[model samples]
Target: AGGQGEGNGLTQLPCPLGLVVDQLGTIYVTDDGNHRIMRWPKGATQGSVIVGGNGGGGQSNQLNGPVGLSFDRHDCDHCEENTDWVLASEPLSHSFQTVKLTHHLLWTVDTNQ
Candidate 1:
C-alpha cells in the first residue's frame, strides 16, 4: 500500500516494517514477522537476509520486531564528512543503534528516538 505502480514487486514481505532505499535501487525491508531484515535488489526474485535469528528481544546484537530504520545522513553532523553511519531503531528494547559501515564501531543509544 505504498504507491500505485513501482516499488511493489508482488513479493509480499510478512509484517513488513522498516524500509529504505540505497543508491543501487536495492530495497531494504525489515520483515518483522520473520524477525529479520532483508534486502531485495530491483528486479530480484527473492530477498536476502541481513539481520536477526528469528528470536525475541535481547541485547546480543539480535533483532526482535525491529520497527524503523533510517540511513539518511542529511542531518548527521559527521556523516557529511565521509562517515558511513546507519541508525536503526528497536522499539522492543527502547533503544537505537548506530552502525558504521566503513569502520567496525557499534554504538547503542539508550534514549528513545
Candidate 2:
C-alpha cells in the first residue's frame, strides 16, 4: 500500500542483502548499502535499526557491509533460556557475528576470525 524510494525510512532501503522473519512475524533486513540491520514490525510503514546503522566500524554496536542473516536454532551451551541468536555475516569486513536478541548484544564469533 506504499512506494519504495530514496529516503530515511522503510521506503528507503538501499542494497538490502539479507532478510529473515522471526517466530512472531517480525521482519529483519540487512541494509547493506546503509551498513545497518533494520527491523520491521509486521505491517509497519518504517523500520528501526536493531544494530549497526551508526556508520561502519569494528565497534561492538556497528556493522559494515552486512550480507547475510539467520537464526541459530541449535541447542548450544552458549544459548541461554532457549533464546535463538541471530547470526550476521559482514563480508566486506570479513566478519561473522551472533546477536543475542534478548539483550540486543552483538558477539564476534565468526569462524573466519
Candidate 3:
C-alpha cells in the first residue's frame, strides 16, 4: 500500500529497491529515494523507519540509495539467545552494513572502513 509519499502513511515509499521479512513476519524495506530503512509489522498499515532516517550520507547512521536487504541469525555472548541481523547494501555509497535487532530495537552497525 506504500508509494510516493512521506510519514507514517501508506504512501510513504518513493523508491523501494529491496525488502525482506523476519521470522516474526516483520517486513523490512530499503527505501531508496528516502535513503532509509523502514519496518512494518504484520497486518500493519503504516511503516516506521528503523535506520538511516536522518538523511542520505556516508555516515554510519545514514544510507545512500539503499538497494538490497537480507536477514540472518547469529549467536551473541551478550544475550542468551540468538539474535537477528539485517544486511543492507547501499549501492550509491558502495557500502554494505549490518544492523542487529536486539530486543526489538535497532542497533546501527559500524561501517568504518
Candidate 4:
C-alpha cells in the first residue's frame, strides 16, 4: 500500500486538524492553519473549500483558531440528518460548536453561543 506523495496522485495535506473517511472514499481535509476545512473527494484534483472562519482578528461561522473537526451524517444528540453537523473546538471562542453539514456547511449551532 502507498499514500502521501506516493505517485503525485495524492500529496501530504497541510494542518490536517481532523480526519474522516466515508464509504465512498472521499477525503475530508481540515486545514487548521488556514482556518478552513476543504474536501478532497475521491478522484478529485483540487481541494474544495468547505468550511472556514475569519482567519484574522475576527470570529465568524468558519472558525476562530479552530483546532479539531469531525463529520457525522446521522441524527444524533440534538441533531438529525437534517442537522448533520461537524464538531470543532475553538480556544478563542473558548468552547465547541456543532456545525450543520447539510446546510451551507457554515451553519453552526453553538451550545455556548
Candidate 5:
C-alpha cells in the first residue's frame, strides 16, 4: 500500500510499524511516522487513513507514535460489519485507543492508570 518513501499520501508509508489483515484481505497498517492508521483494501494500489490523520497529539482525533494494532473481537465477529473496534497502541502517549471500524474514536485507556 506504500510507494518508495515515507509520506502521508495514499501510496506512501513513513515508518510503518504494525499491521493486521481482515478475513476479506483488507490490510490495516499503523503508520507511526505519520501518526495514522491506513486501510488498504485487497488489490488496491492506494489506501485511506482510518484513524489519527491529524498529526501526533494527545487529542481524540490524533495519534502519537501509534506502534501496534489489533482487532477487538469481542464486539463483532467480522470486520466488514463495521462494528469491530481497532485497538491501537500509542507508545508516545502511554495509552491505547480504541477506534471503531466506522472510523470513530471510541475511547482511550491510559496505561499508567
Candidate 6:
C-alpha cells in the first residue's frame, strides 16, 4: 500500500513484509525497514506506530526488522523480529510483552492468567 520511500508516515512504507486485518477493519503492518509496527484504522489517511519505532536494536523497546505478525485470542499482536525474540503488544493499551525463543519454536505464555 506504500510506494513512497522508506518513511514512518502513514502512506510511506519502507519495507512492509507482513500484515493482518482485525475484525474492526484496522490494518496492522510489520514495517521491517522502519523496525516498527503500524496501525492503520479503516478509512484513515495515516497510520500510527503501535510498537517499536524507537530505532533498530536489541533493546527491550526496540525492534530490528520485524518480519511476521499474528494476533492472539486476547487481541494482542505477536510479532517475530529478525532476532531470537518475539514481541507482543496490545494496540489499545500500548503495552509490550516480550518472549525469547529457543530452537526457533513459537509459543505463547499468558502471564496474565
lDDT per model vs. reference: 0.49, 0.56, 0.58, 0.44, 0.63, 0.80
Higher-scoring candidate on lDDT, 2 or 4 = 2
For candidate 1, the C-alpha RMSD (Å) to the true structure equals: 11.8
Off by over 4 Å in 2: 1-3, 74-113
Report the lDDT tens digits of candidate 6 across residue range 30-90: 9998898888888887788777888998777788899888877788888888777678678
Better candidate number, 4 or 5, judged by lDDT: 5
The count of backbone overlaps in candidate 3 is: 0
Per-residue lDDT of candidate 4, residues 4-30 (tens digit)? 532212244445555555446766655
TM-score of 3: 0.58
Instruction: Give one digit per residue, the lDDT tens place, for model 3 in 3-102.
Output: 5465534458878777766656777787777777777888888877766766666555666676666543421101111224444544324355656554
User: Sorted on TM-score, highest at the top, how do the candidates line up?
Assistant: 6, 5, 2, 3, 1, 4
For candidate 4, the TM-score is 0.48
Q: What is the TM-score of each candidate against the true structure?
A: 0.52, 0.59, 0.58, 0.48, 0.65, 0.79
Where does candidate 2 clash, by residue pair? none
lDDT measured at residue 81 in model 6 versus the true structure, 0 to 100:
80
Better of 3 and 6 by TM-score: 6
Q: Which lDDT value does model 3 have at 61?
A: 67
- Greater lDDT among 4 and 6 belongs to 6
What's the CA RMSD of model 2 in angstroms? 11.1
Of 1 and 4, the candidate ahead on lDDT is 1
Clash totals in order: 0, 0, 0, 4, 0, 0
Best by TM-score: 6
lDDT of 1 at 79: 11
The better candidate by lDDT, 1 or 5, is: 5
